[model samples]
Target: MVGAKMSNNLPCGRFEMRISESLQPFIRNGLKGCEKEGLRISREGSISLSPHPVQLGAALTHPNITTDYSEALLELITPALSDGSEMLGFLTNLHRYVCTNIDDELLLSASMPIGDLRSSAIPIARYGSSNIGRMKHIYRQGLSYRYGGCMQVIAGIHFNYSLPESFWLEYQDFTKQPGDPQSFRASAYMGTIRNLQRYGWLIPYLFGSSPAVSKSFVDGRNSAYSNALEKFDETSYYKPFATSLRMSEIGYVNPVQASFRVSFNSLDEYIRDLSKATSIPYLDYERVGTKVGGKYRQLTTNLLQIENEYYTSVRPKQLTRPNERPLRALSNRGIQYIEIRSLDIDVFEPSGISIETTRFLEALSLLCLFHESPAHDIRQYDEVKHNALAVANKGRDPALKLLNKGQEVHLRTWALILCDQLQEICEALDNGNKARPYTQALHKQMEVIRHPELTSSAKMLATMRDQKLSVAELVLQKSREYTSHFQKTPLDNSVKRDFDLQVANSLEQLKRLNNASEIPFDEFLGNYFSKIPEPAKFPGIDRKASQVR
Candidate 1:
């Protein structure tokens, strides 16, 4: 029989043109995760700095990842961006937090108890970091390469450690200025980072890991070395998607540069205290650590060669599937918090992310929560994990089908509607752009998604093909810009002093990292579990009550 045509069947929800009144608090303050600041060097000498994947994760983890922007973000910096120096300064400040404030252990924890393990329980991760479970241990192992061989080097630091809300809000105002280069568009919290001077090494530029280096596991299945987990429109609905780190493999999400903060805990708690979450997926903290061995690093999994007990750790799988005929959409059974995993950090844009884009994400999360999640009869997070990969990497390709509403659906159509839903979210975030940084960024993205000329990944690959620039070169170019920009932002006397102090601190940390030939992994574990050592329960949820249309 001929396959029936898809009707776009976009799921409807109780949504609005503007962010609902209830989510104001969440839009302003619910999620928190992790962020990283790295420098990428490109061959062409054109530099770009990412607003740390960890930071993006951190931003998504918290509902309030969007902070209040100042007219200055709209005013001072947008204009300064033309100068290149100011734009660089602004990004630097944002990167600095990832450099200085991120907790190493939390990041390490993100990957511990590797494989489909972390998903087995409810976890609370610090902003854009990892759950307090085995994931912490896993990341530490990844750091062992050059980071002193001990996970201890990568643990505990809090969100407000260096950059506080006041700092975030300092440049939050961005709309007072009018016009494109002349007028204000939307404000951003990244201004502080963007305008900072003398801060080299604050750029988060690490791209996807090598295919061979990221897996670790006894099961070769977990270590499959293909970027096969993404959905690009393929016939096989449940293709496994995961990378083999040097030691283990955890469940893989699509295209890598995505984010989500989740837990296996109670629905009420997840909902009530989501504002307190701090862990993020897909973000890596910049420690004085290095990736060593012929072993490559995976997306969320970090490593540790500690105490001679090689361990793989990371959050448990979020998606699972039992069958392919019907799409097993979002799950909930006390699956209280919604995972926001579709965002990509736009490198070319200021703030690396934008107010508009974030606002849309904020809206989507709300929509998912307020309305009902669609359903079909499929179970098994492990399978769903593989299905997710099919959706990501193979999404644009033909032959792939996604189950929607108990009926077969083309991945492309689903993706378009998904993007449309995202559009609705962006439009709802902030009618005036004040409260919709996520949405604002999304609207801009909507334009990009539609325009062939602005295809980021495609453009990047094409540039590489045309110019013959190595990925390394493109990364370095990004690094150099951040390096130079930080070299010039004017800092106040106090900040200058603080900056100097931080430099001293960084040097000290670097020294420690350098001196260490090898530290035992056991000690690393000892120190890690000593705090917040209790794991949360996450039994297989029935989720029947949570199903939507």
Candidate 2:
């Protein structure tokens, strides 16, 4: 799918004009979904050491609510919906149901948790006795040993989306491409992923909510990052003009995979490289040992215990069947969706996201999909990483400069240009609707870009400084406020009943999985890694009927 190199400049007006009339309506039908993660905190505002509440259902089997890296980290997922408002409504109900179940515990309202945490203090999430469940638990254990548990506990929102097949068909024809529809669609999605890598920094700058943290977050770490952070107060650390510390090096960014290059040039290249990383052993992890003293310390001594361990701001996703490997699913099928992983869990919004944020992201996804994308090289890849860190650390700096096509450009200048391009996409997304919600969403983000203080990180800092509250204090208060709000407006009876039924069903499913499984863990692990599929081959779309209209 690698094509001729194109200039980084976006062909906004020309691209909009050239898109076929039939394709415009499909823009409004793109599917949107969200996965939001929040830490369960005690009433005193420290990370809760409690296990996942049983009333909410089994964390391993629940469809909507589950644990992420930590037993206390609640990850709530929403089903894909065409309407952003509906998707958010589902997410809201999930939160309300969860709040009703967990007695007295507040959902932490910030991306970065507040408190002093040693790696030993963070609890690894547990699954039951099933082989699959055990694999999940051991994988997290691997993460703790490899990256330390502190990094694993930080939470954020993942926006998942896919354009309608009608849109893809029109887009493929519009581009005069000749390939299998599935192949072309996956290739197009890869192009979008590549563009996302190039421009994804914008998300953190606009929506980033974590700029400061409890000093205890990095209490004893002796690294360059310690010097980078300024003391906000006796209890906190912050960067004066930072956007999202969560997206920065101190967050989920992994230094171990720095030398590993996973290509986005093509689906085959991406699969090949990622698969190789899983097989190649890293000396540091080998020293940690996969199994030590009759206990599994980690999954493999490989650079990546699994593909999920390779943290990135964006990922191409395919739906996986039960017991199927994610890589195998992608190889057998094709790209199903793209996950936007840079979004911070918004502190002010009870749902950790807003309709405005959702609409803006949808428009941004469209822009990435429609834009002409060139394949990435090592130099471009480095620039993307450098730009991401710059925005994460100092995005609100008026003089912040980012590398665009190897030339330095002011952050504000680049942002304005990107917003201008997004305007057309937003308009198309708002077609057939008089409200123009998508356009409004884009305009709101533009205002944030113009007024740096309007960014979430700035607002959070302002609140902290004005009141002289510690990071923990501010978030704890917000958590209490939001939890109260949700409690006041409980879920509708039908919704409540549905959630309750799901909880019962999930527990039953987990029990069955635990009791029915008989395979030895060693054989299960062997079968899993050995099933990694070879690179796929796809035929071109029949060219006889294809014509450039």
Candidate 3:
């Protein structure tokens, strides 16, 4: 067993290699267990100045499908799966299903939405008449009021992953950690999160696809690039060296969230801080008013309506019971998994994400788990946020610098260093004859670093330049092309049957919920909020029970 002192020094090249060699056997053993994953991808499209498709009723009622912020914005979710290929395949079939359903609308292929419409023209997503559905609908309305509906329409992919319990048990034994299996697993997951915060900037550097936006996206807002906006054609705006403008301040900036100091040290601290944010009222949001002209405009005047409202690059997550709050779920059971939220939808991929990208993310997650992660201070947190913004806006710039260990480092230089470490981790992950997809993915990223033009963002800009089309034009063209491709391709019979069943089941479930409610809507909301259980007196007990159930 490696001592704490020994593990602390394993962040460097030689030490990392030695540690990777030592952990290879355990890694292989862990891989033998079932590897599970969950994916949720969101995309926004226009409805030709008409109301959202009446055929696709209230987003709140759907299970596999839903809306993010705008009625036109569609979010497609895949149930958890162990295989990366299966996940992507399911997502593609979902695209096929949606393409067949919607009438006269194209999924916007770019991360940024078509910005030509008025804010009010973008309608908030509506759920049915049920109280829970109304809560979901009104929350989006609050989002539209707080952040412009246009910004909310910007779409991305979320990857939810959990290492099997067997892996953690083996890891605990290998590390000789002094705690129960549950506590060790929770600590490990938190460590992965902290490391991700430190290094996640590299993700956008390599995969960020939104380097430019239509001029209308920034028309009414006070933009830092307002002066630069005039240089492009009246139809488009861009940063010459940007990677993902979608992740920049222009996309989802919230000053109120910025002011709060949320800690990632432990589960208790996280739940406490997040809960406080939900309870504490903000003057700015209060001004928006919960009810306007007898119509509910927002959920509450709090900093956050719920835990899901707190936007970050990554989050610690736990599976919830039937109607359990996310915080309560986390409190009752420690962190079950973590969600990676920084990925932009790659325009070139019909699924919005590629198989290589997903494999690389899994590799990164493993790297975070295997490496040493020190507790971070608020200053470190702020630095990570700054680094993310810098990479999002100016990563491709030759002169860009990012902070590492309180010292300035060239972005490319730091990225290459991390890639080297990922290379080592990939070797550990690649068991003989099992395949080296992780290594292949890491190599691809290394090539992107070597050739800046190979990045998705750069390719997007180049295509626009070569084709002489605007951002909106290019995205719409691709969206149409992909729509045609999906429509022409037939789903596998088994896959088709499963999808049919899921849709049918989701509809039946919605009907059941609608009919089962016996209480008033307001009373339901009151009970829901009031019944949030306090942090469990015993942490590991409910977690084990949850696993059994």
Candidate 4:
């Protein structure tokens, strides 16, 4: 127990390394403002439903979490989303909600528990227990089991929805204006500290050297990877939230996809919790787990099998042996997990996002968790990322080929097949009673591939070349839009000032952290792996260091 840590109440548990007493107000106000922003997404800035329906699965969420962005609609909003005195409650509630998202669930049936799925007490280090926040006493708690250096996970409502300029303008007129890069950091847990300089809606966050136990999972020394950015770049869940790197420099960085994966304590409890949180129905498992007694066994009642007959032997070598694609896996790990990512603040809108998007995400996650299997082994991750990069750079190119079963296939053809599968899955979801919006949303993407204008990469390139904008310049554009929206929201002077001040503080802190230097890479990862998750506290948790370079 000397080196180990657990939840707050545990004698050796770790609380957020920072003190909560100093800035409770900021957390609360931020949470309150987060409510009801969902309308800005799923329903707005979106196309009509697909007639045939499509199932996007975990590729995107079906639930409209954007509304959860608005203080008016979220359970955790009042305290954290506040534009006024509601600050302390705001931060606490905000943290609780995020944890709940990771822990709780709502089933498809009407019956569900009010409490979030009972969660195993997790680590309290939001950014990993560094004792950064100064106002309260920080405690060392229990650390994660498999993953080491578990940062308190940061989760947000990712809605696959958008709104029109007209709608955003109206909301801004009535809301507040405060898009100070600093203030948002009050609740945001990210490593890329420099990117804050650019208030652009789109950001490129870097990943630190992710020396994972699974070598198959990490991509080290990427031409795209940034070192200066790594100071602020978190390799795990904290990466996507913020960055110190300039997006102008790193052409395309995958949004941080950080998540704290937990194997359930009990199936009944897990089922009850997710059912309410998601407002979905759950049926009995057809079979559970891959081998006997595995965590996935709970899912036994419901099985989604991809028949074995489908095999591919023909394709161009380049497409077949994707330098970055995963080799297909034979074992069914059955351990189901989800990643929480893809959160973009809708700078133009009042809520920064909306509700419909959250629900859509919810729907999408269930579809994927219950449906898709990793096409291959963990070793295939490199290819996965490589394919992603190719798409980001040349998604619209018809000649592009991607690896498929040791064969090359037209990227367009692959996309269409994936898209077609989505439609089929959506039709089968809940026995086809209702279709998922993500199916239709795929069209939004197809439209972009057909015409480059809609892709983020395309938009980014166009803006940089045509407008001659630097990263900061583009960020400023987004900031103005968001600030204008916030300012219009009715609020008192004190609240606005406080919010602005918080933003300023965050920015200062971020810049300072980025500017600071560190030890060598070998030493940095050495100290990092020491904290790898173990069942019982490994004696190594007692080790300390100055900082990594």
What are the TM-scores, per candidate, against the unseen true structure? Answer: 0.43, 0.94, 0.89, 0.34
The 0-to-1 C-alpha lDDT of every candidate, in the order given, reads 0.28, 0.84, 0.72, 0.25
Write the residue-wise lDDT of candidate 1 on 1-549 in tens digits.
001111223433222234334333333443323222222212232111223233222221122121111100000111112122333444445344333333221111111111111111212121222222123334433433222221111111111101123322321222123333211101111111111100100011111111111121112223233343332222111122211111112222211111222322222232222212211211232232233363323212221122112111111112223211001112121111222222233433423443333333344333333232222113322233333434334332355565434445554444445556555544443446565555545555455435423444445444545775543343334434443443345445674565455445544543454355543444444444333222232233221222111
Q: Which residue pairs come into collision in candidate 3?
A: none
User: Between candidates 1 and 3, which one is better according to TM-score?
Assistant: 3
- Deviation from native of the Cα of residue 455 in model 3, angstroms: 0.4
* Model 3 C-alpha lDDT per residue in residues 214-267, reported as the tens digit of each score: 776777444554564333456888888888887887776666677666778777
Model 3 poorest ten-residue lDDT run? 32-41
Scored by lDDT, model 3 comes in at 0.72
For residue 541, model 1's alpha carbon misses the true position, in angstroms, by 17
Between candidates 2 and 4, the TM-score winner: 2
TM-score of 3: 0.89
For TM-score, the strongest prediction is 2
Q: RMSD of candidate 1 to the true fold?
A: 17.0
Candidate closest to the true structure, highest lDDT: 2
Error of 2 at 426 (Å): 1.2
Q: How many backbone clashes does candidate 3 have?
A: 0
Better of 3 and 4 by lDDT: 3
lDDT of 1 at 5: 14
Flag regions of model 3 displaced more than 4 Å. Answer: 1-14, 18-45, 48-58, 220-230, 531-549
Q: What is candidate 4's lDDT per residue for 68-111, written digit by digit as tens?
A: 11111122233222122233234333322222232111111000
Q: Is candidate 1 or candidate 4 better by lDDT?
A: 1
